[model samples]
Every structure is written in C-alpha cells, then in structure tokens.
Target: MTETFTYTDDLQIEVVNEGTAKFEDQKPQALIDLKSWISDEIKAGNIEGWLPYNNFESSVTWKIIPK
Candidate 1:
C-alpha cells in the first residue's frame, strides 16, 4: 500500500512502505512517477524544502522544510 503523511504544518510529505507494502520493489515505474509528482509540487510551491534520499533503498519520501 502507498501511505502518505503530511506533517510540519502540511508542508512536508512523508511516504513509506509499511508491513507487507513494498511498492518500490514491485514497481519501478511507481517510483519514477512519484518523483515527478514531488517535483511538480515543489515547482508549484506546495512542498517547501528539499533533501537527498534519506535511506538505503530507493527513497520513498519527499520532505521539504523552509529555511
């Protein structure tokens, strides 16, 4: 399952695979699409910050914090 959590005043997006949910492993296209969506949001002034991938595996998060 794809789960998204919004925190930090709704300016951040935290996505992950929990339990039996491993979307990245099963579908590479999903990851690509996800990044594209994130980029669009950032360009549209939705999310507020940017960072490098946070984990060992392909990243499943888009967290941006204003400076």
Candidate 2:
C-alpha cells in the first residue's frame, strides 16, 4: 500500500487509516531540511525524541527527524 501525507506541527503526522508511519531514508533534500527543522523543533520544546526505521527488514535502519 502506498501512503502519502503531509507534515503538521502537532508533533505527529496524520496517516490515512494506516496509523502513523515510520519514514525511510532521508532523501538529499530531506537531510538538509531535517537538520534545520529538528534543531528548531527541539529548541521550541516540541518533541525530544528520535525516529528510526528499517528498510524492508534488511537490517539497515535510517534515523530521521520527522517534519
């Protein structure tokens, strides 16, 4: 199933009937944006947690700061 959604501020992403999802690798653009967003969000005292996900169960997990 292909799930698509946008990011919102409330510290959680809204998924369509799939429950929240764990993001995969941070794309080139994602990496850049994450650096800034994460810093800002953390400073703002929104959420101090990290998200980690595996890619197709290959033992390769990517850590990301969700937007």
Candidate 3:
C-alpha cells in the first residue's frame, strides 16, 4: 500500500493510505519512523534541501510509493 504523510502540528501527523482511502493519525513512534525514512531517502539523494527540522512548521507531504 502507498501512504501519504502530512506533518501538521506537534505530535499530529496525518496519514492517508492510498490503497484503502483511509485516513488516520500517526502514532508517536511513527515520528521516529518518519525521521529515519527521510534520512534514508536523503542519503539516497531522493530529496534535496529539506530536512525534518527545517520543514516542521510548514506543510510537507511525503508520498510512499509502492515498489
């Protein structure tokens, strides 16, 4: 399944599952998972100029595309 994560306020991450059209709040642990995922993607050079700390206040959307 593909998921889209939208970072909102503190401890409020909105998750949208594309396959099921389901929406829910990400668990606290998901924050760590997200950070790790972003870090990996950055290392792979998938994204540029945006870090987790720098984009917290603004709206950031990350799509987890299925392989």
Using lDDT as the measure, the top candidate is 1
Candidate 2 per-residue lDDT over residues 1-67, each given as its tens digit: 1223334463333222221332334356643554455557556765443333243231111122356
Task: Score candidate 2 by TM-score against the native.
Answer: 0.29
- TM-score ranking of the models: 1, 3, 2
Question: What's the TM for model 3?
Answer: 0.34
- State TM-scores per candidate: 0.43, 0.29, 0.34
Query: Candidate 1: lDDT of 51?
Result: 31
Candidate 3 lDDT, 1-67, residue by residue in tens: 3344443332222233232222235556655766566658656866423333323533234533332
Those runs of model 2 whose alpha carbons end farther than 4 Å from true positions after fitting are 1-27, 48-67
| Clash numbers, per candidate | 2, 0, 0
lDDT of 1 by residue, 1-67 (tens): 4444433464545555433445456578865666677768778876533333425434444556432
Query: Any idea what lDDT model 2 has?
Result: 0.37
When 1 and 3 are scored with TM-score, the better candidate is 1
Best by TM-score: 1
